[model samples]
Target: MTFQWDAIWGALPVLLEGAKLTLWISILGLLGGVVIGLVAGFARAYGGFFSNRLALVFIELIRGTPIMVQVMFIYFALPLMVPVRIDPFGAAVVTIMINSGAYIAEITRGAVLSINRGFREAGLALGLSGRDTLRYVIAPLAFRRMIPALGNQWIVSIKDTSLFIVIGVAELTRQGQEVIAGNFRAMEVWTAVAVIYLIITLALSYTLRRIEGRLKIL
Candidate 1:
């Protein structure tokens, strides 16, 4: 069958709204994930027994589960357990944060550990406190090393946001489904959706490449 430009054009605005929600979810999730990752990474790197065990448990729990299950649990199961109810969008963001956090923690931990032991010794010799050394010396270098991995996580998180459609969040996949339902044009709608996703992913990769280049120069 021929490609249907009209169907795609008609679906654009609806998909745009979904795209915006996806972007918001990804950005907020990435921010939360980075914070959790940094904390977990530090714990694994420097914290004593209790902190190390806790971080290990968290990372394992998140990484071991399917993200779809995590999203479903946050959206469906958590409300039954807690007084606070999160909407689909909030749930999606939270799941992304938790999922990405696990992966990012690994990245951070690896990056920090890969730094030469001499750096830590040098920091101590320079009279820097453990926290100060991590903040000033270790973290900066570790974060630079983490850029490429983090970029990959960001891309994965963005794609994963499509899973939020199960909870009724109007992300691109859900928008495409709606359009297909209305027009009975599944092939056309899905193709358009794929192209949109490709465009967004390419743009994001390009932007991150520029950022990586700048960071390398600094």
Candidate 2:
């Protein structure tokens, strides 16, 4: 069968809208993931026994599960157990935050631990309190090391947004499915959808590369 150029052209607007929502939710979710990762990472790295154990359980539980199951549980199961009912969009964002946070926490822990112990000791000797030393000395250096792993997680989280089609979030994959449903142009719609994802991920990779270069200089 001849490829349907017209179907792709016609579906561009809807696909772009879906792509926008994908990017939006990814950014929001990964931002929150970064915050969650930082706390969990530090707890695992430096906190006392209970805090470390708690963070370990959280990280392990999240990392052990599939994101689809997590989102499904949030959207469909949680309402049965609690006074909370998250809509599809909210569920998608929450799941990405949690799923990515687990991985990011591991990345953060590795980066922080890779730094020499002497730097930390030196900071303490210079009259910096433990909190101040962590903030002013350790965090900046570890963050530099985190750039690549964090970039990877960001890209993974963005692609993971497509899975939200299972929950009907109208993200890029769902838009492609809808377009194909209306026009019976699965080949064209799916090709357009894939190219859009490639464009976004490639652009993200390029931007992260530039940022990594600049950070290396500092």
Q: Tell me, what's the RMSD of every candidate?
A: 1.4, 1.1
**CA lDDT, candidate 2, residue 168:** 94
Over 152-210, each residue of candidate 2 has an lDDT whose tens digit, in order, gives 99899999999899989999999999989999999999999999999999999999999
The C-alpha lDDT values of all candidates are 0.91, 0.93
Stretches of candidate 1 exceeding 4 Å from the true structure: none
lDDT of 1 by residue, 1-218 (tens): 88878988898899888888888999999999999998998889889999999999999999999999999999999989988899998999999999999999899999999888788889999999988988888889889989989999999999999988899998999988988888998888888888888999999999989888888723
CA lDDT, candidate 1, residue 209: 91
Clashing residue pairs in all predictions, respectively, total: 0, 0
Name the 10 consecutive residues with the lowest summed lDDT in model 2.
209-218
lDDT of 1 at 122: 92
In Å, residue 51's CA in model 2 sits off its true spot by 0.7
lDDT of 2: 0.93
lDDT agreement of model 1 with the native: 0.91
